[model samples]
Target: MAEKKFRSGFVAIIGRPNVGKSSIMNKLVGEKVAIVSNKPQTTRTKIMGVVNGEDWQIVFLDTPGLHKPRTKLGEYMMKQASEAREGVDAVLCVVDGQHIGPGDRAVMEDVARMNCPKFLAVNKVDVTTPEGLMPQLQQLATIGFDEIVAVSALRGDNMDKLKDLLSGAMPEGPKYFPDDMITDQPERLICAEIIREKALLNLREEIPHGVGVEMLAITKLSDKLTEIHANVYCERASHKSIIIGKQGAMLQRIGSQARYDIERLLDTKVLLKLWVKVREDWRNRTGDLRAQGYED
Candidate 1:
Protein backbone atom coordinates (compact mmCIF):
# COMPACT_ATOMS: atom_id res chain seq x y z
CA MET A 1 0.00 0.00 0.00
CA ALA A 2 1.15 3.49 -0.77
CA GLU A 3 1.74 5.82 2.15
CA LYS A 4 -0.22 9.03 2.50
CA LYS A 5 1.54 12.14 1.30
CA PHE A 6 2.48 14.88 3.76
CA ARG A 7 0.77 18.25 3.49
CA SER A 8 1.68 21.65 4.90
CA GLY A 9 0.74 25.29 4.42
CA PHE A 10 0.17 28.62 6.16
CA VAL A 11 -3.19 29.93 7.35
CA ALA A 12 -3.62 33.57 8.30
CA ILE A 13 -6.26 34.20 10.98
CA ILE A 14 -7.61 37.72 10.54
CA GLY A 15 -10.44 39.51 12.26
CA ARG A 16 -11.36 42.77 13.95
CA PRO A 17 -10.54 43.49 17.59
CA ASN A 18 -11.80 41.11 20.29
CA VAL A 19 -13.23 38.57 17.85
CA GLY A 20 -11.48 35.57 19.53
CA LYS A 21 -8.86 35.04 16.84
CA SER A 22 -6.14 34.42 19.43
CA SER A 23 -8.42 32.10 21.39
CA ILE A 24 -9.15 30.04 18.30
CA MET A 25 -5.47 29.84 17.39
CA ASN A 26 -4.57 28.78 20.91
CA LYS A 27 -7.31 26.15 20.82
CA LEU A 28 -6.23 24.87 17.43
CA VAL A 29 -2.60 24.59 18.53
CA GLY A 30 -3.61 22.96 21.84
CA GLU A 31 -1.32 25.41 23.59
CA LYS A 32 -1.16 29.10 24.43
CA VAL A 33 1.00 30.52 21.67
CA ALA A 34 -0.64 33.93 21.62
CA ILE A 35 -1.67 36.22 24.47
CA VAL A 36 -5.44 36.65 24.83
CA SER A 37 -7.56 39.26 26.56
CA ASN A 38 -11.08 40.66 26.37
CA LYS A 39 -9.82 44.13 25.54
CA PRO A 40 -9.81 45.19 21.94
CA GLN A 41 -6.43 45.18 20.16
CA THR A 42 -4.71 43.11 22.78
CA THR A 43 -2.36 41.49 20.34
CA ARG A 44 0.26 43.91 19.04
CA THR A 45 2.21 41.63 16.74
CA LYS A 46 1.94 38.58 14.50
CA ILE A 47 2.26 35.39 16.51
CA MET A 48 2.83 32.02 14.84
CA GLY A 49 1.12 28.87 16.13
CA VAL A 50 1.85 25.47 14.58
CA VAL A 51 -0.46 22.45 14.55
CA ASN A 52 1.01 19.07 13.70
CA GLY A 53 -1.34 16.37 12.40
CA GLU A 54 -0.74 12.77 11.37
CA ASP A 55 0.05 13.61 7.76
CA TRP A 56 -0.26 17.34 7.63
CA GLN A 57 1.03 20.42 9.43
CA ILE A 58 -0.77 23.73 9.54
CA VAL A 59 1.15 26.91 10.35
CA PHE A 60 -1.21 29.50 11.75
CA LEU A 61 -0.41 33.20 11.98
CA ASP A 62 -2.33 34.83 14.79
CA THR A 63 -2.17 38.51 13.94
CA PRO A 64 -3.11 41.66 15.78
CA GLY A 65 -6.78 42.59 15.52
CA LEU A 66 -7.29 44.78 12.46
CA HIS A 67 -8.27 48.32 13.35
CA LYS A 68 -7.68 51.90 12.30
CA PRO A 69 -4.29 53.16 13.43
CA ARG A 70 -3.97 56.12 15.73
CA THR A 71 -0.33 55.89 16.74
CA LYS A 72 2.98 54.55 15.50
CA LEU A 73 2.55 51.32 17.46
CA GLY A 74 -0.99 50.97 16.18
CA GLU A 75 0.26 51.48 12.64
CA TYR A 76 2.81 48.72 13.13
CA MET A 77 0.15 46.38 14.46
CA MET A 78 -2.20 47.10 11.59
CA LYS A 79 0.61 46.46 9.15
CA GLN A 80 1.36 43.14 10.81
CA ALA A 81 -2.31 42.14 10.64
CA SER A 82 -2.73 43.10 6.99
CA GLU A 83 0.52 41.55 5.75
CA ALA A 84 -0.20 38.19 7.38
CA ARG A 85 -2.50 37.10 4.56
CA GLU A 86 0.06 37.60 1.82
CA GLY A 87 1.26 34.39 0.08
CA VAL A 88 -0.71 32.19 2.48
CA ASP A 89 -2.41 28.98 1.43
CA ALA A 90 -5.62 29.94 3.18
CA VAL A 91 -7.22 32.76 5.16
CA LEU A 92 -9.48 32.09 8.13
CA CYS A 93 -11.53 35.21 8.72
CA VAL A 94 -13.11 35.03 12.16
CA VAL A 95 -16.10 37.04 13.47
CA ASP A 96 -18.23 37.24 16.57
CA GLY A 97 -21.33 35.11 16.10
CA GLN A 98 -23.33 37.13 18.62
CA HIS A 99 -22.75 40.42 16.82
CA ILE A 100 -22.36 40.68 13.08
CA GLY A 101 -21.77 44.38 12.56
CA PRO A 102 -19.98 46.65 10.12
CA GLY A 103 -16.59 45.61 11.46
CA ASP A 104 -17.31 42.02 10.46
CA ARG A 105 -18.26 43.10 6.98
CA ALA A 106 -15.14 45.26 6.68
CA VAL A 107 -12.87 42.35 7.54
CA MET A 108 -14.71 40.00 5.21
CA GLU A 109 -14.52 42.54 2.41
CA ASP A 110 -10.74 42.57 2.75
CA VAL A 111 -10.68 38.78 2.87
CA ALA A 112 -12.80 38.71 -0.30
CA ARG A 113 -9.94 40.33 -2.15
CA MET A 114 -7.46 37.67 -1.09
CA ASN A 115 -6.42 35.10 -3.69
CA CYS A 116 -6.24 32.13 -1.33
CA PRO A 117 -9.06 29.99 -0.07
CA LYS A 118 -11.11 32.02 2.39
CA PHE A 119 -12.76 30.30 5.37
CA LEU A 120 -15.19 32.09 7.65
CA ALA A 121 -15.36 31.11 11.29
CA VAL A 122 -18.24 32.36 13.45
CA ASN A 123 -17.07 32.20 17.03
CA LYS A 124 -18.84 32.56 20.44
CA VAL A 125 -21.57 30.06 19.60
CA ASP A 126 -21.54 28.75 23.14
CA VAL A 127 -22.97 32.05 24.32
CA THR A 128 -25.50 32.34 21.53
CA THR A 129 -28.52 30.11 20.90
CA PRO A 130 -29.34 28.54 17.58
CA GLU A 131 -32.17 31.02 17.10
CA GLY A 132 -29.87 33.90 17.94
CA LEU A 133 -27.23 32.67 15.51
CA MET A 134 -29.61 31.94 12.65
CA PRO A 135 -29.87 35.45 11.34
CA GLN A 136 -26.12 35.96 11.48
CA LEU A 137 -25.51 32.64 9.78
CA GLN A 138 -28.01 33.48 7.09
CA GLN A 139 -26.36 36.80 6.52
CA LEU A 140 -22.89 35.23 6.38
CA ALA A 141 -24.03 32.56 3.95
CA THR A 142 -24.36 35.18 1.30
CA ILE A 143 -20.61 35.79 1.43
CA GLY A 144 -18.23 33.72 -0.71
CA PHE A 145 -16.45 31.82 2.04
CA ASP A 146 -15.22 28.44 0.86
CA GLU A 147 -16.27 26.96 4.20
CA ILE A 148 -17.94 28.33 7.30
CA VAL A 149 -17.95 26.81 10.77
CA ALA A 150 -19.55 28.14 13.90
CA VAL A 151 -17.51 27.30 16.96
CA SER A 152 -16.84 28.18 20.57
CA ALA A 153 -13.07 28.29 20.83
CA LEU A 154 -13.12 28.62 24.57
CA ARG A 155 -15.27 25.53 25.14
CA GLY A 156 -13.58 23.44 22.42
CA ASP A 157 -16.87 23.13 20.60
CA ASN A 158 -16.52 21.80 17.05
CA MET A 159 -12.78 22.39 17.26
CA ASP A 160 -11.91 18.96 16.01
CA LYS A 161 -14.16 19.44 13.01
CA LEU A 162 -12.64 22.83 12.40
CA LYS A 163 -9.18 21.31 12.61
CA ASP A 164 -10.14 18.67 10.08
CA LEU A 165 -11.50 21.30 7.72
CA LEU A 166 -8.29 23.30 8.00
CA SER A 167 -6.12 20.23 7.57
CA GLY A 168 -8.04 19.26 4.45
CA ALA A 169 -7.29 22.62 2.92
CA MET A 170 -3.54 22.11 2.92
CA PRO A 171 -1.65 21.25 -0.24
CA GLU A 172 0.69 18.27 -0.53
CA GLY A 173 4.11 19.46 0.61
CA PRO A 174 6.91 18.84 3.07
CA LYS A 175 6.32 18.97 6.83
CA TYR A 176 7.18 22.60 7.57
CA PHE A 177 7.59 22.05 11.29
CA PRO A 178 8.81 19.11 13.31
CA ASP A 179 6.31 16.97 15.22
CA ASP A 180 7.26 18.35 18.62
CA MET A 181 7.46 21.97 17.54
CA ILE A 182 4.25 23.97 18.13
CA THR A 183 5.33 27.56 17.46
CA ASP A 184 8.03 29.78 16.02
CA GLN A 185 7.97 32.36 18.81
CA PRO A 186 11.03 32.62 21.01
CA GLU A 187 10.77 31.80 24.70
CA ARG A 188 11.63 35.36 25.67
CA LEU A 189 8.85 36.80 23.51
CA ILE A 190 6.31 34.31 24.86
CA CYS A 191 7.28 35.08 28.42
CA ALA A 192 6.90 38.79 27.77
CA GLU A 193 3.48 38.16 26.24
CA ILE A 194 2.48 36.02 29.22
CA ILE A 195 3.34 38.82 31.61
CA ARG A 196 1.52 41.32 29.42
CA GLU A 197 -1.56 39.10 29.33
CA LYS A 198 -1.68 38.85 33.11
CA ALA A 199 -1.38 42.59 33.39
CA LEU A 200 -4.18 43.05 30.89
CA LEU A 201 -6.44 40.71 32.83
CA ASN A 202 -5.80 42.45 36.11
CA LEU A 203 -5.70 46.09 35.04
CA ARG A 204 -8.69 48.31 34.32
CA GLU A 205 -10.22 48.54 30.84
CA GLU A 206 -8.51 51.79 29.88
CA ILE A 207 -5.10 50.54 30.93
CA PRO A 208 -4.51 47.44 28.80
CA HIS A 209 -3.82 48.87 25.35
CA GLY A 210 -1.30 51.32 26.76
CA VAL A 211 0.44 48.60 28.76
CA GLY A 212 3.55 46.85 27.44
CA VAL A 213 5.63 44.18 29.14
CA GLU A 214 9.28 43.71 28.31
CA MET A 215 11.33 40.77 29.52
CA LEU A 216 14.54 42.13 30.97
CA ALA A 217 16.29 38.93 31.92
CA ILE A 218 15.70 35.21 32.27
CA THR A 219 18.39 33.53 34.27
CA LYS A 220 18.59 29.90 35.30
CA LEU A 221 19.35 29.98 38.99
CA SER A 222 19.29 26.22 39.37
CA ASP A 223 18.12 23.03 37.73
CA LYS A 224 14.67 23.43 39.27
CA LEU A 225 14.25 27.20 39.48
CA THR A 226 14.54 30.08 37.03
CA GLU A 227 14.41 33.81 37.64
CA ILE A 228 12.64 36.21 35.31
CA HIS A 229 12.64 40.00 35.48
CA ALA A 230 10.22 42.10 33.46
CA ASN A 231 9.23 45.72 33.15
CA VAL A 232 5.60 46.74 32.61
CA TYR A 233 5.41 50.08 30.83
CA CYS A 234 2.41 52.37 30.82
CA GLU A 235 1.69 55.71 29.21
CA ARG A 236 1.20 57.77 32.37
CA ALA A 237 2.48 58.09 35.90
CA SER A 238 -1.02 57.55 37.24
CA HIS A 239 -1.33 54.32 35.29
CA LYS A 240 2.01 53.26 36.72
CA SER A 241 0.72 53.93 40.20
CA ILE A 242 -2.39 51.88 39.49
CA ILE A 243 -0.32 49.01 38.13
CA ILE A 244 1.89 49.02 41.19
CA GLY A 245 -0.97 49.76 43.61
CA LYS A 246 -0.57 51.00 47.16
CA GLN A 247 2.10 49.04 49.00
CA GLY A 248 2.75 47.09 45.80
CA ALA A 249 -0.43 45.01 46.02
CA MET A 250 -1.42 45.25 42.36
CA LEU A 251 2.03 44.43 41.05
CA GLN A 252 2.11 41.45 43.38
CA ARG A 253 -1.17 40.18 42.00
CA ILE A 254 0.03 40.49 38.42
CA GLY A 255 3.31 38.69 39.19
CA SER A 256 1.59 35.93 41.17
CA GLN A 257 -0.77 35.21 38.30
CA ALA A 258 1.95 35.37 35.64
CA ARG A 259 4.39 33.10 37.46
CA TYR A 260 1.96 30.20 37.55
CA ASP A 261 1.52 30.24 33.78
CA ILE A 262 5.21 30.92 33.18
CA GLU A 263 6.21 27.91 35.27
CA ARG A 264 3.82 25.72 33.29
CA LEU A 265 5.22 27.11 30.06
CA LEU A 266 8.90 26.70 30.97
CA ASP A 267 8.51 23.44 32.94
CA THR A 268 10.32 24.91 35.94
CA LYS A 269 9.59 27.08 38.91
CA VAL A 270 9.94 30.78 38.15
CA LEU A 271 10.60 33.82 40.28
CA LEU A 272 8.92 36.56 38.28
CA LYS A 273 9.87 40.11 39.20
CA LEU A 274 7.71 42.91 37.81
CA TRP A 275 8.34 46.65 37.77
CA VAL A 276 5.98 49.36 36.64
CA LYS A 277 7.42 52.18 34.56
CA VAL A 278 6.00 55.14 32.69
CA ARG A 279 6.99 55.62 29.07
CA GLU A 280 4.76 58.55 28.37
CA ASP A 281 3.24 58.53 24.89
CA TRP A 282 5.46 55.66 23.83
CA ARG A 283 2.85 54.47 21.37
CA ASN A 284 3.20 57.58 19.24
CA ARG A 285 6.98 57.64 19.18
CA THR A 286 8.71 55.46 16.59
CA GLY A 287 11.93 55.13 18.57
CA ASP A 288 10.09 54.23 21.74
CA LEU A 289 7.86 51.80 19.86
CA ARG A 290 10.91 50.05 18.42
CA ALA A 291 12.55 50.04 21.83
CA GLN A 292 9.46 48.23 23.12
CA GLY A 293 9.94 45.67 20.31
CA TYR A 294 7.11 46.86 18.09
CA GLU A 295 9.21 46.74 14.93
CA ASP A 296 7.79 44.98 11.93
Candidate 2:
Protein backbone atom coordinates (compact mmCIF):
# COMPACT_ATOMS: atom_id res chain seq x y z
CA MET A 1 0.00 0.00 0.00
CA ALA A 2 1.11 3.54 -0.72
CA GLU A 3 -0.02 4.57 2.76
CA LYS A 4 -1.97 3.15 5.67
CA LYS A 5 -5.12 4.78 4.32
CA PHE A 6 -6.68 3.66 1.04
CA ARG A 7 -5.37 5.35 -2.15
CA SER A 8 -7.16 5.68 -5.45
CA GLY A 9 -6.67 7.97 -8.44
CA PHE A 10 -6.66 8.21 -12.21
CA VAL A 11 -3.39 7.50 -14.01
CA ALA A 12 -3.06 8.33 -17.69
CA ILE A 13 -0.87 5.92 -19.69
CA ILE A 14 0.72 7.97 -22.47
CA GLY A 15 3.47 7.14 -24.95
CA ARG A 16 4.44 7.05 -28.59
CA PRO A 17 2.66 4.54 -30.83
CA ASN A 18 3.45 0.83 -30.18
CA VAL A 19 5.58 1.46 -27.09
CA GLY A 20 3.65 -1.16 -25.02
CA LYS A 21 1.44 1.35 -23.21
CA SER A 22 -1.67 -0.74 -23.74
CA SER A 23 0.26 -3.89 -22.94
CA ILE A 24 1.34 -2.45 -19.60
CA MET A 25 -2.21 -1.50 -18.62
CA ASN A 26 -3.68 -4.83 -19.70
CA LYS A 27 -1.07 -6.75 -17.78
CA LEU A 28 -1.65 -4.69 -14.64
CA VAL A 29 -5.42 -4.95 -14.81
CA GLY A 30 -5.19 -8.69 -15.65
CA GLU A 31 -7.41 -8.55 -18.74
CA LYS A 32 -7.24 -7.46 -22.36
CA VAL A 33 -9.42 -4.37 -22.27
CA ALA A 34 -7.16 -2.60 -24.76
CA ILE A 35 -6.35 -3.94 -28.22
CA VAL A 36 -2.62 -4.25 -28.94
CA SER A 37 -0.67 -4.73 -32.15
CA ASN A 38 2.80 -4.16 -33.55
CA LYS A 39 1.30 -1.57 -35.89
CA PRO A 40 1.40 2.06 -34.86
CA GLN A 41 -1.79 3.89 -33.86
CA THR A 42 -3.63 0.63 -33.15
CA THR A 43 -5.26 2.25 -30.17
CA ARG A 44 -7.64 4.95 -31.36
CA THR A 45 -9.33 6.12 -28.14
CA LYS A 46 -8.97 6.33 -24.36
CA ILE A 47 -9.88 3.04 -22.66
CA MET A 48 -10.05 2.70 -18.89
CA GLY A 49 -8.93 -0.31 -16.86
CA VAL A 50 -9.34 -0.49 -13.08
CA VAL A 51 -6.75 -2.13 -10.84
CA ASN A 52 -7.74 -3.00 -7.31
CA GLY A 53 -5.12 -3.78 -4.70
CA GLU A 54 -5.70 -4.79 -1.10
CA ASP A 55 -6.13 -1.19 0.05
CA TRP A 56 -5.89 0.85 -3.18
CA GLN A 57 -7.56 1.20 -6.54
CA ILE A 58 -5.85 2.68 -9.58
CA VAL A 59 -7.98 3.60 -12.58
CA PHE A 60 -5.62 3.45 -15.55
CA LEU A 61 -6.68 5.37 -18.64
CA ASP A 62 -4.93 3.88 -21.68
CA THR A 63 -4.88 6.57 -24.32
CA PRO A 64 -4.05 6.46 -27.99
CA GLY A 65 -0.35 6.79 -28.73
CA LEU A 66 0.95 10.15 -29.88
CA HIS A 67 1.21 10.48 -33.63
CA LYS A 68 1.30 13.14 -36.34
CA PRO A 69 -2.22 14.04 -37.44
CA ARG A 70 -3.06 12.98 -40.96
CA THR A 71 -6.86 13.09 -40.80
CA LYS A 72 -9.80 13.91 -38.56
CA LEU A 73 -9.47 10.47 -36.97
CA GLY A 74 -5.77 11.04 -36.27
CA GLU A 75 -6.59 14.46 -34.87
CA TYR A 76 -9.20 12.97 -32.58
CA MET A 77 -6.70 10.32 -31.42
CA MET A 78 -4.02 12.85 -30.46
CA LYS A 79 -6.63 15.07 -28.86
CA GLN A 80 -7.84 12.10 -26.75
CA ALA A 81 -4.26 11.37 -25.69
CA SER A 82 -3.72 14.93 -24.45
CA GLU A 83 -7.16 15.16 -22.90
CA ALA A 84 -6.46 12.04 -20.81
CA ARG A 85 -3.77 13.87 -18.79
CA GLU A 86 -6.15 16.57 -17.65
CA GLY A 87 -7.28 16.41 -13.99
CA VAL A 88 -5.51 13.08 -13.47
CA ASP A 89 -3.51 12.15 -10.39
CA ALA A 90 -0.46 10.92 -12.33
CA VAL A 91 0.85 10.60 -15.88
CA LEU A 92 2.79 7.43 -16.81
CA CYS A 93 5.11 7.98 -19.77
CA VAL A 94 6.12 4.68 -21.43
CA VAL A 95 9.09 4.46 -23.76
CA ASP A 96 10.74 1.56 -25.60
CA GLY A 97 14.24 1.20 -24.19
CA GLN A 98 15.49 -0.33 -27.42
CA HIS A 99 13.95 2.38 -29.61
CA ILE A 100 13.62 5.95 -28.33
CA GLY A 101 13.50 8.85 -30.74
CA PRO A 102 11.45 11.85 -31.96
CA GLY A 103 8.09 10.12 -31.57
CA ASP A 104 8.73 9.52 -27.88
CA ARG A 105 9.89 13.12 -27.42
CA ALA A 106 6.82 14.38 -29.24
CA VAL A 107 4.67 12.41 -26.80
CA MET A 108 6.45 14.05 -23.85
CA GLU A 109 5.88 17.49 -25.39
CA ASP A 110 2.13 16.81 -25.43
CA VAL A 111 2.04 16.23 -21.67
CA ALA A 112 4.83 18.62 -20.61
CA ARG A 113 2.49 21.29 -19.31
CA MET A 114 0.38 19.03 -17.11
CA ASN A 115 0.46 19.83 -13.42
CA CYS A 116 0.39 16.25 -12.13
CA PRO A 117 3.50 14.26 -11.32
CA LYS A 118 4.90 12.21 -14.21
CA PHE A 119 6.43 8.71 -13.97
CA LEU A 120 8.64 7.52 -16.79
CA ALA A 121 8.49 3.75 -17.44
CA VAL A 122 11.01 2.14 -19.77
CA ASN A 123 9.32 -0.93 -21.25
CA LYS A 124 10.74 -3.82 -23.32
CA VAL A 125 13.62 -4.25 -20.88
CA ASP A 126 13.74 -8.00 -21.40
CA VAL A 127 15.14 -7.36 -24.88
CA THR A 128 17.15 -4.22 -24.07
CA THR A 129 20.88 -4.31 -23.33
CA PRO A 130 22.43 -2.27 -20.53
CA GLU A 131 24.22 -0.17 -23.17
CA GLY A 132 20.97 0.28 -25.11
CA LEU A 133 18.93 1.07 -21.99
CA MET A 134 21.27 3.61 -20.33
CA PRO A 135 21.02 6.19 -23.11
CA GLN A 136 17.23 6.15 -23.03
CA LEU A 137 17.34 6.64 -19.29
CA GLN A 138 19.89 9.47 -19.57
CA GLN A 139 18.02 11.20 -22.38
CA LEU A 140 14.76 10.89 -20.46
CA ALA A 141 16.46 12.16 -17.27
CA THR A 142 16.96 15.50 -19.07
CA ILE A 143 13.14 15.77 -19.36
CA GLY A 144 12.43 16.13 -15.59
CA PHE A 145 10.35 13.20 -14.32
CA ASP A 146 9.20 12.58 -10.74
CA GLU A 147 10.04 8.85 -10.82
CA ILE A 148 11.36 6.30 -13.31
CA VAL A 149 11.28 2.49 -13.53
CA ALA A 150 12.53 -0.08 -15.99
CA VAL A 151 9.92 -2.73 -16.85
CA SER A 152 8.90 -5.35 -19.38
CA ALA A 153 5.18 -5.23 -20.01
CA LEU A 154 5.47 -8.34 -22.20
CA ARG A 155 7.10 -10.68 -19.69
CA GLY A 156 5.67 -9.20 -16.47
CA ASP A 157 9.12 -8.04 -15.37
CA ASN A 158 9.22 -5.58 -12.47
CA MET A 159 5.44 -5.11 -12.66
CA ASP A 160 5.09 -5.49 -8.91
CA LYS A 161 7.64 -2.73 -8.37
CA LEU A 162 5.97 -0.52 -10.96
CA LYS A 163 2.58 -1.07 -9.35
CA ASP A 164 4.02 -0.12 -5.99
CA LEU A 165 5.50 3.06 -7.46
CA LEU A 166 2.17 4.04 -8.98
CA SER A 167 0.32 3.25 -5.77
CA GLY A 168 2.72 5.31 -3.69
CA ALA A 169 2.36 8.29 -6.02
CA MET A 170 -1.42 8.52 -5.61
CA PRO A 171 -3.13 10.50 -2.89
CA GLU A 172 -5.42 9.03 -0.28
CA GLY A 173 -8.85 9.01 -1.87
CA PRO A 174 -12.10 7.05 -2.15
CA LYS A 175 -12.31 4.00 -4.39
CA TYR A 176 -13.69 4.74 -7.85
CA PHE A 177 -14.78 1.18 -8.63
CA PRO A 178 -15.65 -2.07 -6.93
CA ASP A 179 -12.89 -4.64 -6.43
CA ASP A 180 -14.48 -7.01 -9.00
CA MET A 181 -14.86 -4.43 -11.75
CA ILE A 182 -12.01 -4.53 -14.25
CA THR A 183 -13.20 -2.15 -16.95
CA ASP A 184 -16.02 0.32 -17.61
CA GLN A 185 -16.00 0.25 -21.40
CA PRO A 186 -19.29 -0.55 -23.14
CA GLU A 187 -19.62 -4.09 -24.50
CA ARG A 188 -20.33 -2.86 -28.03
CA LEU A 189 -17.19 -0.76 -28.04
CA ILE A 190 -15.10 -3.66 -26.82
CA CYS A 191 -16.68 -5.84 -29.50
CA ALA A 192 -15.61 -3.35 -32.15
CA GLU A 193 -12.10 -3.23 -30.79
CA ILE A 194 -11.76 -7.02 -30.76
CA ILE A 195 -12.80 -7.17 -34.39
CA ARG A 196 -10.42 -4.35 -35.25
CA GLU A 197 -7.62 -6.13 -33.42
CA LYS A 198 -8.06 -9.24 -35.54
CA ALA A 199 -7.99 -7.15 -38.71
CA LEU A 200 -4.90 -5.34 -37.57
CA LEU A 201 -3.17 -8.64 -36.97
CA ASN A 202 -4.25 -10.31 -40.22
CA LEU A 203 -4.34 -7.56 -42.81
CA ARG A 204 -1.52 -5.88 -44.69
CA GLU A 205 -0.07 -2.58 -43.48
CA GLU A 206 -2.02 -0.31 -45.83
CA ILE A 207 -5.34 -2.08 -45.21
CA PRO A 208 -5.43 -1.98 -41.41
CA HIS A 209 -5.22 1.85 -41.22
CA GLY A 210 -8.23 2.29 -43.51
CA VAL A 211 -10.30 -0.34 -41.71
CA GLY A 212 -12.81 0.43 -38.94
CA VAL A 213 -15.31 -1.88 -37.25
CA GLU A 214 -18.88 -1.00 -36.28
CA MET A 215 -21.26 -3.03 -34.14
CA LEU A 216 -24.55 -3.21 -35.97
CA ALA A 217 -26.39 -5.53 -33.62
CA ILE A 218 -25.69 -7.66 -30.56
CA THR A 219 -28.11 -9.79 -28.60
CA LYS A 220 -28.08 -12.70 -26.23
CA LEU A 221 -29.55 -15.87 -27.67
CA SER A 222 -29.24 -17.71 -24.38
CA ASP A 223 -27.61 -17.16 -21.01
CA LYS A 224 -24.51 -18.83 -22.40
CA LEU A 225 -24.28 -17.34 -25.90
CA THR A 226 -24.39 -14.03 -27.79
CA GLU A 227 -24.90 -13.16 -31.46
CA ILE A 228 -23.18 -10.10 -32.93
CA HIS A 229 -23.51 -8.47 -36.32
CA ALA A 230 -20.84 -6.01 -37.36
CA ASN A 231 -19.61 -4.12 -40.38
CA VAL A 232 -15.97 -3.47 -41.33
CA TYR A 233 -15.67 -0.15 -43.16
CA CYS A 234 -12.93 0.71 -45.61
CA GLU A 235 -12.07 3.73 -47.74
CA ARG A 236 -12.15 2.15 -51.16
CA ALA A 237 -13.63 -0.78 -53.03
CA SER A 238 -10.22 -2.28 -53.57
CA HIS A 239 -9.60 -2.26 -49.85
CA LYS A 240 -12.94 -3.94 -49.27
CA SER A 241 -11.98 -6.63 -51.78
CA ILE A 242 -8.71 -7.14 -49.99
CA ILE A 243 -10.44 -7.43 -46.63
CA ILE A 244 -12.98 -9.92 -47.95
CA GLY A 245 -10.23 -11.85 -49.74
CA LYS A 246 -10.66 -14.48 -52.48
CA GLN A 247 -13.54 -16.84 -51.72
CA GLY A 248 -13.91 -14.88 -48.48
CA ALA A 249 -11.11 -16.88 -46.86
CA MET A 250 -9.46 -13.81 -45.32
CA LEU A 251 -12.74 -12.54 -43.93
CA GLN A 252 -13.50 -15.95 -42.47
CA ARG A 253 -10.11 -16.08 -40.80
CA ILE A 254 -10.59 -12.65 -39.29
CA GLY A 255 -14.05 -13.54 -38.01
CA SER A 256 -12.93 -16.84 -36.51
CA GLN A 257 -10.08 -15.19 -34.66
CA ALA A 258 -12.17 -12.26 -33.44
CA ARG A 259 -15.00 -14.53 -32.30
CA TYR A 260 -12.66 -16.53 -30.13
CA ASP A 261 -11.50 -13.38 -28.36
CA ILE A 262 -14.99 -11.89 -28.04
CA GLU A 263 -16.27 -15.12 -26.58
CA ARG A 264 -13.56 -15.00 -23.96
CA LEU A 265 -14.27 -11.37 -23.17
CA LEU A 266 -18.02 -11.85 -22.83
CA ASP A 267 -17.62 -15.23 -21.11
CA THR A 268 -20.15 -16.70 -23.51
CA LYS A 269 -20.20 -18.29 -26.92
CA VAL A 270 -20.21 -15.62 -29.66
CA LEU A 271 -21.78 -15.87 -33.09
CA LEU A 272 -20.18 -12.99 -34.99
CA LYS A 273 -21.20 -11.96 -38.52
CA LEU A 274 -19.09 -9.43 -40.43
CA TRP A 275 -19.74 -7.38 -43.56
CA VAL A 276 -17.46 -5.08 -45.53
CA LYS A 277 -18.52 -1.65 -46.79
CA VAL A 278 -16.73 1.02 -48.78
CA ARG A 279 -17.10 4.40 -47.07
CA GLU A 280 -14.76 6.40 -49.39
CA ASP A 281 -12.28 8.17 -47.14
CA TRP A 282 -14.18 7.70 -43.91
CA ARG A 283 -11.04 8.49 -41.96
CA ASN A 284 -11.12 12.08 -43.20
CA ARG A 285 -14.88 12.53 -43.16
CA THR A 286 -16.19 14.04 -39.93
CA GLY A 287 -19.65 12.48 -40.20
CA ASP A 288 -18.25 9.04 -40.93
CA LEU A 289 -15.86 9.30 -38.02
CA ARG A 290 -18.72 10.31 -35.72
CA ALA A 291 -20.97 7.55 -37.00
CA GLN A 292 -18.24 5.00 -36.37
CA GLY A 293 -17.95 6.28 -32.74
CA TYR A 294 -14.64 8.08 -33.23
CA GLU A 295 -16.17 11.29 -31.87
CA ASP A 296 -13.96 14.36 -31.98
lDDT of 1: 0.89
**Model 2 regions more than 4 Å off:** 1-4, 109-113
Clashes of each: 0, 0
RMSD in Å for candidate 2, one decimal?
A: 2.1
Q: lDDT at 2 for candidate 1?
A: 96
Q: Which runs of model 1 end up more than 4 angstroms from their true locations?
A: none
lDDT of each: 0.89, 0.89
In the predicted model 2, the residue pairs found to clash are none
Positional deviation of residue 124's Cα in model 2 after best superposition, in angstroms:
0.9
lDDT of 1 by residue, 58-108 (tens): 999999988889888889998898788778999999999988889889889
